[model samples]
Target: MATLLHIDSSALPQGSASRDVTAVFRKTWEEQHPEGTVVYRDLAANPLPHISATALSVGSVDPAEFTAEQRAAHDLRVELAEELERADAVLIGTPMYNFTIPSSLKAWLDQVIIMGRTAGEKPSAAGTPVTVVASRGGSYAPGTPRESFEFVTTYLEKVLTGMLGLEVDFIVPELTLAATVPAMAELVGKSEASRAKADEEAVTKAKALVARLAG
Candidate 1:
């Protein structure tokens, strides 16, 4: 059975487009792989601390020389890396904040990006499939005025694919705030269309992943 590492970093508990889309994907994954296991992490609920100088040196420094705080930080990083390393696939629900991913999600990514474990030579998570549900409050697609401000998916693609060598797929729902923001009322139809497409892609891709990995 396949194991999935599911992570959500939306600070908003409700009305989060990324969370909603990822839930659809997760449900489809469960239906297709009933015996599969999912290791869930809510980064909003339990945010990881930013990597400190000591934490950054954990891989190179001898464990025997670690201070109490450093050891604790190192342990958390190890756990995060192991979770990713063991998963057959990864799912991340990230909402754009200030034109990029929420800091909560970035913290989680920092934790799992172990030097020797996920990067460097002989990387353990090199070939894992990572599905990212990236939701934006406003339109940032090509041709949109805010397209240049879109750093969420672009940054993630660079890190997850270029750095760690993961196969990353994106399901983007744009103009998420249009549903409730009066100023964006004119874009509501387009927003709904984007969400619908994201939903459909989530289900289709989830099923395809299951078939490819679990079959």
Candidate 2:
């Protein structure tokens, strides 16, 4: 059976635009692949440990020479990397926090990105398709006032594709706080439009991914 590695890093689970859109994608994906497996991680609910000195040294350490602490940390890193290696596709739901990804998400990445495994020239999961739902509170696309602050997608695109060698696709829902933030009231319509487009794109992308996998 095919497997989907789904991760959600939003602290605000109920109202997060990224979570909502990822749910759409996952729902459509499961419908298309009824026998598929889903390995889910809710980072905000159960955050991963940041990479420690031991975890960072896992790739070079002689397994026979590991200390108890080092061995445990290395094992965790291997487990996380192996999960990625086993997946057919990856889905990430990340909301912008201070113009970048959440610390929880970063922690997960740290644990999983072991050199010679997930991040090297021959990344274990290289070429796996990954779709990211990146939700932002305000407009940060090119030509927008905050365009220069758009780090979430740009940074992820580089890291996922450049470093991990994953095939990356992004669905961004901008101006997510427009309806609730008083100063963004004028852009509520645009926010709604962006959300609608994101939801539609989520389904389309999920179907396309299924088709690609099947073919």
Candidate 3:
């Protein structure tokens, strides 16, 4: 059976749009592939440290000459890379923070996107595929007025496609601010309703995809 790696990076566990939607996706996926194993990593609650300069330094020093800290960092990076390499599929749940992916998620990326593992050795080799399920409060898809504010999805797509050679797929639920306040309250209501509906549809679609892939 295939193993699925589910990484959730939203700080808000209960009310996070990204987490909530990802939960739905995972539920549908589990139903379709009940025998598959899942490894969950919550980056927001248990954040990984940023990569250090020592980890990047290359030298001719013998293995016994390496400092303890350097060895520890290298081991952590190797562990993260191994988890990603072993998974048949990876699902990342991210919410746009300051118009881009959160720092926690970026740190995780630094650990897993290792050279000679995920990518970077060959100039033209096809890389592993990853799907990101992202949630945002505003509309950022193409043709929307806020489309210009779509750096989050575009940046991820570019990095995954160009650097890692991953076939990237995105599920974005937008217009989240359409309901609660005095300004655009009605719009917010409509958008929230739309997003709720989309959440269900996305879950169904994700399940079907998983079934097809696993079978």
Candidate 4:
């Protein structure tokens, strides 16, 4: 059976656009692969510790020489790496926070991105498909005033594909706050359309990726 790692980093548990779209992706995947297994991680709720100097040095130092904290950190890193390695696909839900991904998600990335394991030349998780549902409070597409400020999708694509060697797909729901914000009233319709398109794409991509992996 196929295994999927599902991660959610949105602090807002309820009514989160990223979560909503990712739910669609996950549901579709489960339907297609009824015997598949899913591993879920809610980064916001159960946040990972940021990488410390000890964590960076854990690999170089002998296991017997490691401090208690370093040993624990190393263990967590290994667990996260194993989770990714076992999974055929990873689905991540993240909302843009301060023009980028949440700190919780960043910490999780730091933990899994090891020197010669998940990162470096010929990383272990190479070719693994990683689907990201990126929800943004404002529109940051090309030509938009905040386009340059958009770092969520770009940064993830770089780190997941370039660093960890995973194939990346992004499903973005832009202007998520337009419907609730008075100044963004005019963009509400656009936001809804964007979400609708994302919902459809999520299902299609989920099924396609799982089928390709199965074959």
Candidate 5:
């Protein structure tokens, strides 16, 4: 059975837009692949530390001559790398904060996107596959005025597709309800309707992709 890594980076519990959308995707994914296993990681609740200077320097020195700090860092990186390599699929819930991916999410990325492990220097190869489910509270799709202001989606696509060589898939639900006050009121009034619509759309796309993957 395939394993799916579900990563949630939002600090907000029930009210987080990213988590809310991710939940929808996860439910749909589980329904489609009842035999698949899921490993959930809540970065907000249990945050990962930033890479230390010791961690980087450890690679320069021989492992036999490494200090305690260097060994600890190496162990952490190894553990993180193993989790990523073992998973068949990854589902990341990311929100735009200050027009970029969340710091917690970035930290998680640092742990997983390791050199000579998750990616790097493989001659003959079929690349890995990764899917990201991004949620934001603004209209930033192409042709929209705020599209250029979006760094989150573009950066992720470049890193995952261009750098890591993963077949990247993304679901971006435009949360336009928060665009204006009256709209916000209406959104609160019919939040379930909005969520349901977004969920339906995401589920349809995700299921199709999964079927292709299984085939």
Candidate 6:
């Protein structure tokens, strides 16, 4: 049976744009693969420890020579990597935070991105498709003044594709704060439209992805 690794990192548990879209995608996926497995991780609720010297250094040393602390750290890293490697697909929901991904997601990346394993020439999870629901408070697409400041999709595309060799696709819901943020109040209509489109894409993409995998 297929397995999907679903991860959510939005700090806002409620009314999270990315989370909403990801939920739609996952629901569609579940409908298609009723017997499939889903491994879910709520990064904000249970944040992973950031990479430490011991964890990073353990990769370079011989496993037989690892100290007690280093061995423990290495084991955690191995577990995370193995979980990723076994996935048929991945789903990540992340709201743009400070123009980038949240610290929780970054910490998970650091822990899972070990050289010669998940990040090397022959990445263990290579060719796995990862769909990212990248929601943002404001428009930052090309031609926007803040385009250069947009880092969430660009960074993730590089890390998930370039480094990890995963196939990355994005469903962006921009201007997510229009309904609540005073500065973006005028864009409420646009935000709603964006969210609607994202939801539509989530369903379409999820169905198409499942079909492609089944093929």
The ten-residue window of minimal lDDT in model 4 covers: 61-70
lDDT of each: 0.91, 0.93, 0.76, 0.94, 0.73, 0.94
Maximum-TM-score candidate: 4
Q: 193 in model 4: Cα distance from truth in Å?
A: 0.6
Q: Model 4: runs farther than 4 Å from truth?
A: none
TM-score of 1: 0.97
**Candidate 5 global TM-score:** 0.85
Q: TM-score each candidate.
A: 0.97, 0.97, 0.89, 0.98, 0.85, 0.97
lDDT of 3 by residue, 1-215 (tens): 87778899988878777888778878887888899888999999899998678665522346677788777777787788778777777788998887889899999887666666566855232454466878787777779887887778888888777776766777787766556546766677667776777687668766766876767
List model 2 lDDT by residue over 128-189, tens digit each: 99999999999999898889998899999999988889999999999999999999999999
Please report the TM-score between candidate 2 and the true structure: 0.97
* CA lDDT for candidate 1: 0.91
Residue-by-residue lDDT tens digits, candidate 1, 132-185: 999998988899788899999999999998778899999999889997999999
Worst 10 residues of 2 by lDDT: 51-60
Ranking by lDDT: 6, 4, 2, 1, 3, 5
Flag the better candidate by lDDT, 2 or 5: 2
* Per-residue error (Å), model 3, residue 186: 2.4
Q: What residue runs in model 3 are displaced by over 4 Å at the alpha carbon?
A: 58-62, 122-127
- Evaluate model 4: give its TM-score: 0.98
Better lDDT candidate (1, 4): 4
